[model samples]
Target: MNFNREDMNIVIVGHVDHGKSTIIGRLLADTNSLPEGKLEQVKERCRRNSKPFEYAFLLDALKDEQEQGITIDAARCFFKTEKRDYIIIDAPGHIEFLKNMVTGASRAEVALLVIDAEEGIKENSKRHGYLLSMLGIKNVVVLINKMDLVNYDEKVFENITKEYTEFLNKIDVEPKCFIPVSGFFGENIVDPSNKMSWYKGQSVLEVLDSFEKEKLPDDKPFRMPVQAVYKFTRDGDNRRIVAGTIETGRVKVGDEVIFYPSGKKSTVKSIEVFNGEARESIGSGYAAGFTLNEQIYIKRGEMAAISGDIKPKVTNRIKVNLFWLGRSPMVKEKEYILKVGTSKVEVKIEEITKVIDASNLNNEVKQQIDRHEVAECILKTDKPIAFDLSHEIAQTSRFVIVDKYEIAGGGIILKELEDEENKAHKENYKWEKSYITLEERAEKFGQKPALICITGKENTRKKAIARALERKLFSDGRRVYFLGINNTLYAEDHNKKEHIKRLSEVSNIMMDSGSILIATASELNRDDIETMEAAVNSKEVIKVWVGENEISEIDEDLFVSKEDTVELAVDKIKSLLQKKNIIFKPF
Candidate 1:
């Protein structure tokens, strides 16, 4: 088979001590890709440690790795078969290093799952396979290594291969090729082995060389997520270039494109690459900058796609399938930072709809998602961010969740909720009244004053203040709706953005009802505080500061002591309510 110089990235993955590194080392050595004198240095180091020379040492060249005899980090090694060049990523097999494994596997186009013939399919081996599938890696080649330890027995290889194939079937990963080889003995790797005459399959190198590289799709709609904007002054020429890798499809010199989330439109003036102008059109897998005919506003992470093909939607609510890797349990009502593509937005878990059992891919009904558990949960962001479904667009659909500067989870967007009525309903308030509607009561009571309570931490104090103020206002016969800071049931779970959006919705409800809106929340940031202030009825919102320090932004001396109980505070607030000329009868 003829091979072209296409870029093929392969990841070596399996359980620990499954001869993955050994196979890679042998592949590099047999292909003459190792640097001169590097092999001799490894050999000397092995001898100094009183250890026999191992092929795996060639790849695990790190000193720490040599001491521990375990690969702690993913290592990338470059080599070439006679047909094509390859960048081989050796992923760690330990379960503790699963994050590192994901880091490596994310860059690979194909995976090489190594299995020991004697041990058959193991825990990490199956796990790596399952993760690869989740990452959308469809190309896999299974290698049954350590055949020499089994006396190169064909029956042993066949039995293990059959068992592994069954396990892979359960996970829905059909390997393109399964080869039996001994990396230590240098058999069935670079060349065919005569010892295993029962096996007539191609060698490892031959199979890899023969595998067809999937071509980038060119017929789909053009999508270029703007990564950067460049203004270059060279040789007295001023040029503005919008640069990013083409995520999918193709674009030409005169195609009309739109910058999303902003809805700005422009026509492409020219496509520029580093090596000068190209004669043909550029498609996916190429990073090129384009100059637009009209100077329009475009920023990083903004998607530019062919106009009228597929419009990007800005949504606040999204459903995602998450894989948690955090130390603490993913609790409801907490907020976390979500980084998707180039946007970092505040997000909250709305609900733990269901937890997924990774072992069998079954949904487990639970309230919390613990570490190492996969779940289908709903996430709501503070603002609308452009995204596509995982099946529709994998590049823009994936995201990572960070809490306290560490990546706690990663997930893919499953579905984007787009019903405007449902969106409004999710953010609306439903209240039961006694005598009159809130608007009529406020109009009748001669403008009942409103109270806005703000705090800086999530604690019982926030809720306690709200309840106390509500009771006092009720006693004074004022129309009031005490909006608590509980957002756990809003969006399938308590997502931070959803919670904040819920707060915004409550503010709107207060404005529409024309009632005294009293909101209590902990750690309300400057922006959220401003949003709440803007949404309340200006004629009635009585701003109440209920914490230690005074919020200097809002010009009001409504500071209430944090130590006061709700009843005592209500008495003090009642006098203030009377002085403001606000009166209503208790219902």
Candidate 2:
């Protein structure tokens, strides 16, 4: 039994007061991993307080935790068997601390789901089971703790095991085995229990050694998000190197790579290191840098991937399965920052498809995702981002939402949604440089040029609102124009794409002249918006939906109800324009 093998991470999770900490404490004390006199110190403290000593006090070192008698944080402990070393992560069972539990369990390969035999299956028991599967922990073992209270009855253990297995099966989680254990008395943990002769199975220590270590993803598609681009000219050792830690697969010198979201192509020139020997190749889990053959201008947040491998999806919209743990409910019409890999971008909840109750597995159709609720939603980013689907590469598919500078939620990307702007036929045409920069034009006009698309259903008051907005802006001493989509000049043919292209060309001219171009196109889909954005280089396109029911799948910036009068709609659009800085606010 070689104990020098790779270490395995295992998380212990269950409901509050279900003996999670007790199990960890017993495992540590039994393995002789505790420091000298540490156990005596805790026992003396318990005696001073006139309380009996328990095994749970060994890991709950926090004063608050000792007084409250519940784990507030994810505590960690280490122990070793003859086969391999184990890092046991003790996650909290309180519902308020589910976010901390998720953070800890995400780093583990196996999960230990404990259930109170005397309390039967509780709410957190089911919730923890589902989360274990969602976190990609495939190997799970059921620990029926506190069997002493149940008189070590085999029937009590079997009934709880049957109920939990059914729940796990619904979530596609199959437990490896169910072991009845008394962590308080250390039965079925390290030594066999003489009380239960009918049960003949491996101990908890034996099961830990049976689980295999998860293999590193060195054979998958290569993925490395560019962290920084360094150029050190101080010592005359000028090497334009792109540096990042590889998330998966391996890379070698001379390999053709493509930077995502920009589609820039380059070949790896040379592997780089500081104060070390030269290398020709590098694998995952190592921070490395390499120069490129072409001088491509790629900034941070761009994913550097091998060309021949499965290319990452680039889009502004995605469908994800996420859990909300924010102080406020995740609602529509508000923006949040989504961080995935090294890329952070402004994201908004476009639509909430379903909100799931993790404990009962019940789903409801709602517009907002409340705290502690799991939801499947469509999120649209302000710009395009590069990512892989969770099924393809789980490492790069995970992301977190930052609200008010705090990580309020986390999730995995389920599917990539095609954005019309990103799906447009990409060409290698170079833009003709203008003599004056955009800053010069913006300063001269006292406002930034923009393309305002007033879109909604056919019967909605889109054209009326568009004309009213243009009239108000013009009266306010600003250059503005109202163009109808069905203008006879470009509406001659029925080709919608060609018609949109021509309209976009006209709008581009108006925007270039520093005028706010308001175009009314009814039932405009995402593809139409993409075409218009591609034509107007670098200008912001604000889609204002002028109806209650948004039939088209356009990611609109503002929504004005059709019940509002033309004056109110115009005011709403004006306020939005001011907020977006399309027009200067009055001092």
Candidate 3:
């Protein structure tokens, strides 16, 4: 679609009741961009609801929102000024409507942060500002709205502006312009206000029109996040096309391009837009399709860009700053659905390095992130996905975490998985040596107690103890199998079996190995523990309880303790081995 000479995409955002919708409505009415009967229809609806005719009602269309007298979703309104055509997105200011704000702001190049002159900077106002920074929106114009409510007082405007400026400075966002206006009174929005003659500044529209679009980074590498794939069969042509809006740089025909993660390379055959193939090259801001010379597997959501200058990395773990909005607390064990651009994958919160106290933005690592809290966390996905740092590339860096089908949090990746191959190799080697040495010793000793399951209330503490025990057992020249719950072998093929059968299988494997299996299970009920005990056979089983819970009424000696150290637990197990008369040479 062709735009006017000064066409720009601008999003209006602020706290709810900050007059975002009214500003848009007044701009449309003043510019004569409203459709013929649209205003009349809005008026009729307002009357039926016993509400005063609000210009905001012209844009907010959701029935629930209109009934509640609040905007719950982002509303898009297109209008034109004498100078430029604008696609103005009116985003909700309510804190719960943050995801809607992100959706709207992600599309716009410029943002108008509307703050109330009467209320100053509220929570949602600061939150919107922080989110804008996270989204990489630098071109911001802070509108100090409700000048009429503040009696168009210059002092009120100045005070609020000063306070907001301080807050913005703390967050590293410097507003390009600060304009005082009244959306309800239609003052200083489309035209200059005579009442604010002391404030010799340009009108809102004038400032927007005068503001220059931030220059594209000259040093930025080519990045195209694949949005969709097109297969055109028009009479004769049967071509496969990959299409997306370029996030940065430029790509030309015959440029060597690479698909991420898969690392498949191909030459760009042609750059095709809606108006057929373009003779020149296509740059950022244009949605275009490219046909590759060879058929390489390029899927939707995969990034395709110039190969040599920049390459996307496949990473399993990432350190990111997350804003948790889920009703449920974000726990480490539970998995969350993550979406970066079009790529979606299930990821677990591996480690919450720090939970930022949103009230003061303090780093609190040990504290659990509750609803509406922002946290710096480490996440590990089930598979390797392409990613970049937010500072390096905003498009690939930002992501949203979803829980129970609702967007819970949004974040930016701070660091990608580093030294992953080396870590993987070390882990593999450890597991291999443990398994090999245990099997060899088992064969020699004729299948002794190979597995030692450590029952506990906390899985993390249990794993830590299990690791320490593995070292101790291996040093004592005994085969030790330290099986973590995350083991893929046990996770797979356990779906079809009954609950009892699954436990039995795990126990049978531990026994067959003839090596002590030190593992932990959380929330182990009496029945489950009994099933596990029976599976391993009471004669060969040694139970270590971490909490005050009776194992079973069976004939097996149990060691129960509330001690929190791994060393103490290891000593108890060592004493038990001595009591059993299992003699072995220490390494």
Candidate 4:
């Protein structure tokens, strides 16, 4: 069904008991949008049970009680004005139902966040605002609901608006407007209320009508994350259809498409659909599937894009602006599943840059993000996934974190970061072979080549420990070298991230040359360790913590203390090397 006016999907959100359902019921009733006798049937049931009538009852338990405003689920109803038609999504407001709320609001183009004038801004009020921003729903209108409870006072509305507006601004969400309304009394709902003469602006119906329909992003680069590959060969059609909704730009027959992170290319052979006209093209916002000329082994979680236009970035590391809703604190090292469009990746928190309290916009430096806290952090995925930056493509860049089968957090991809696992170094596999192999080199050196990284906080003697071990090995006539921070940073590419990569690369070369390389970096963390390991090999890399490190992210192969004697530290390191078969005991 099509409407002459713009069609919109709007989610009504706020805290529990904040009158979201009441406003939805009032809008449907006021606009005469409900089905025939649906409203009366509900009222009659209420009358039969001798219960008070509630507008919220129309929404929850559609076949059951009318008072069930919240069944802890997101439910949709239809309503329309002369200007536009709406699919009003009633998102659950209870804190336990956050996942349901995200499911409803994630697809909404606009949101109406209700607040109780008497209760003021509550916890979920600020939280929902934060979510809308992260979900890329910038078109929001705040409703200071239940003005009748506060006697339709203008000052009360103004005060609540000021406080809530300030909170939204902290999360970088500027609401479109604030409206005062009593959903129960129908004040400023469909029609402006004479009781609220001071509210001279548009009514709720007017604002709903005035909101510009969310336009499809047809002009941007074409991106459709591969949701599935279908081979319906049994139905006399032998086409493999690659399916997903186009997040941006358009696609036409014969267009050259590239499946990314893999960088494989294919051409669109035909537009496949259940039943439609002989369509030659499709654009963004359509759930389109296409048959490729050549069936490449592409799978879900890889994005399909049009070649020669803008391309999606392929990387395993990204910096995100995220909100945590997990019952447990979002601690580093805990693996979580991140879903962006059709891509699902195993991800771990690499760093917590900053955690912001949504209620007061207070920024704190914390190692973990607790439930309902917002944070800026870096994430390292198990593999690369294709994506555009959040600011560039809102639909494809936003993602949710799933912890234990529940959406524990949601965030937007702010930036792509360089990872040690990038394919740039994969070219080394093409190098010419040497007759004297790694095993021969190890036999000549009398020890297996390994990269030992000593990491600790500043003034913790990490470098001292690394130098001591290198000296002990050198004294024993073993091939060993120590590279400190200044050794790697003495030249160009001295940034923290680049330095880590360079250190790992240099260590890999030295190890290949039959010399054990001991490196020391005070700023090293788990991501750096992973990068170092990826550069060389995990089994060939040994991590030793020199002092107190609070994070549980990295599992060190060995631990030393500042109080341990240098000779004792060296002895312990040699013992571990022997245990790992990196070295053999000598007479």
Q: Who wins the TM-score comparison?
A: 4
TM-scores of all models?
0.67, 0.68, 0.67, 0.71
lDDT of 1 by residue, 262-319 (tens): 5668998888897786534689867898988987546676778888787655676888
Who is ahead in TM-score, 2 or 3? 2
Scored against the true structure, residue 85 in model 1 reaches a CA lDDT of 78
Off by more than 4 A, model 3: 1-4, 40-51, 61-77, 93-106, 215-219, 230-238, 278-280, 419-422, 426-587
- Give the Å error, residue 483, model 1: 24
Which portions of model 1 show Cα errors greater than 4 Å?
1-4, 62-77, 93-106, 233-238, 278-280, 360-362, 419-422, 425-587
Per-residue lDDT of 463-492 in model 3, one digit per residue for the tens? 777788789878767767776545523444
Q: Which ranges of candidate 2 are over 4 A from the true structure?
A: 1-4, 62-77, 93-106, 230-234, 272-276, 423-587
True-structure RMSD for candidate 3? 15.6
Expressed as tens digits, the lDDT of each residue in 405-469 for candidate 4 is: 97888778899999755555544445564677899988787889898887777887787778888
Worst 10 residues of 4 by lDDT: 68-77
lDDT of each: 0.71, 0.80, 0.70, 0.80
Q: How many backbone clashes does candidate 1 have?
A: 16
Number of the predicted model whose lDDT against the real structure is largest: 2
